[model samples]
Target: MSSVLPMDLLTYWNRYAEAPITVEESRERGFGWTQYDRHGPAEELLGQPETSLELGCGTGDMTAYLARKNVRAVGVDISPVQIEHCRQRWPQDGAEFVCSDVLTYLAGTTQKWDAIFSNWGALWFTDPRAWLEPVRDHLTDNGVLVFSCAPPVEGCYGAQGMYGNGFRGRVLPVQRWAYSPEMWEGVLRNVGFLEVYAKVLEAPEPDNLGTLIVQAWAR
Candidate 1:
């Protein structure tokens, strides 16, 4: 199946540019993979790699956070507006932002990273069957891949349609991939990843949703 059109994603994400993580908030809290801060910082899972790339880095908050920690960090997003906003928000030396489809960027770049991560980002929105292999190819030996997304809905796995609130009364179309933690681990292993781990971090409140965080080693 065809993926969500980039233009649609760009338009949908442009609506978020008005309200981004403030500089103070970014400096103080950095970034978290789980919604509602239910889990610890993402860096703990990442293990402080010397070079890292963040896929679908909205507003570049996480990228800037890593750069401050002295990691050479690059953030990639499909939205030019969000990327421009990121560039303006974090004009530091270590952080870099590129506006491109995540899969295209991964396939085109020859540079490898020590760690690659997505925080409710591209890995959720893209087809992993088409994505995981190139991601493995772009990582240094034994490099780490980490990401988080909402736990999969029962009976709904694979590319699914999601509607985003757009300008005025309009609703935009997007596609997202959802899979159970077990399914995710299997897919990663099939893509040549080793030491695969996937778990759902339950929300603090019983009524709220949980996050599925996955980590794997490139081999």
Candidate 2:
């Protein structure tokens, strides 16, 4: 099992933001082309939401898209540099980016969101009950939260799973999490979200990793 340090990952993403341009690895790891084929977060916008919050927005590409939709969109990420890139791409006054762990913001802040969504994001929570409840609490009464999560491709639980087989004692962390289909179904119900739409989509690619997508309506 491999353990993940969420804050550390955020700081690493910040370094990418300082680069002259988006790096090749960042482009791949951020997962736009593959995730976009299935989720198309931009296309799903229902038109000018009164307010929107996106968690784990990498490079803030989709957040910028949301801003242009004439919606009040705010993106929260753990990376300061990522926030900087976001600031540069879309200068709309209403589109804001924050530097904080999504869980920390959700737990500490009293703000309620009108609509919440994350793409290729929201899977860092080792304890779903702990992390997800915060997400649910941050949602307004009639609000919606949509995100994509995946279970590990193989046996991975804590440190061993996350780091994979260490080569000569040097550990490399690969993709870290995945959820069983049934596990996801139950989590939403426990969080008081009614099943609106759930689908298993082919991840774009030669690799073609799969995605378990659940978009639920809040009760």
RMSD of 1: 2.7
Which is the leading candidate under TM-score? 1
Give a tens-digit lDDT track for model 1, residues 1-219: 344565666777787666886777767776789877435556878886999999999989888888988999999998888899899989964799999989989888899999999999988888888888888888898689999998988899888976675344455677799999999999999878878989988888877898899999966
TM-score of 1: 0.91
Q: Any idea what lDDT model 1 has?
A: 0.85
Pairs of residues clashing in candidate 1: none
What are the lDDT scores of the predictions, listed in order?
0.85, 0.62
- Across residues 1-219, which tens digit of lDDT does each residue of candidate 2 receive? 346565555544665457533434433343232344333333353333577888877677666666766767888877777777777765664578887777877877898877787766544433566667777777777777766655345654422234333466434354434555566677678777775555555655536666656666667
Error of 1 at 162 (Å): 1.9
Regions more than 4 Å wrong, model 2: 1-7, 15-42, 45-48, 124-126, 150-160, 164-175, 204-207
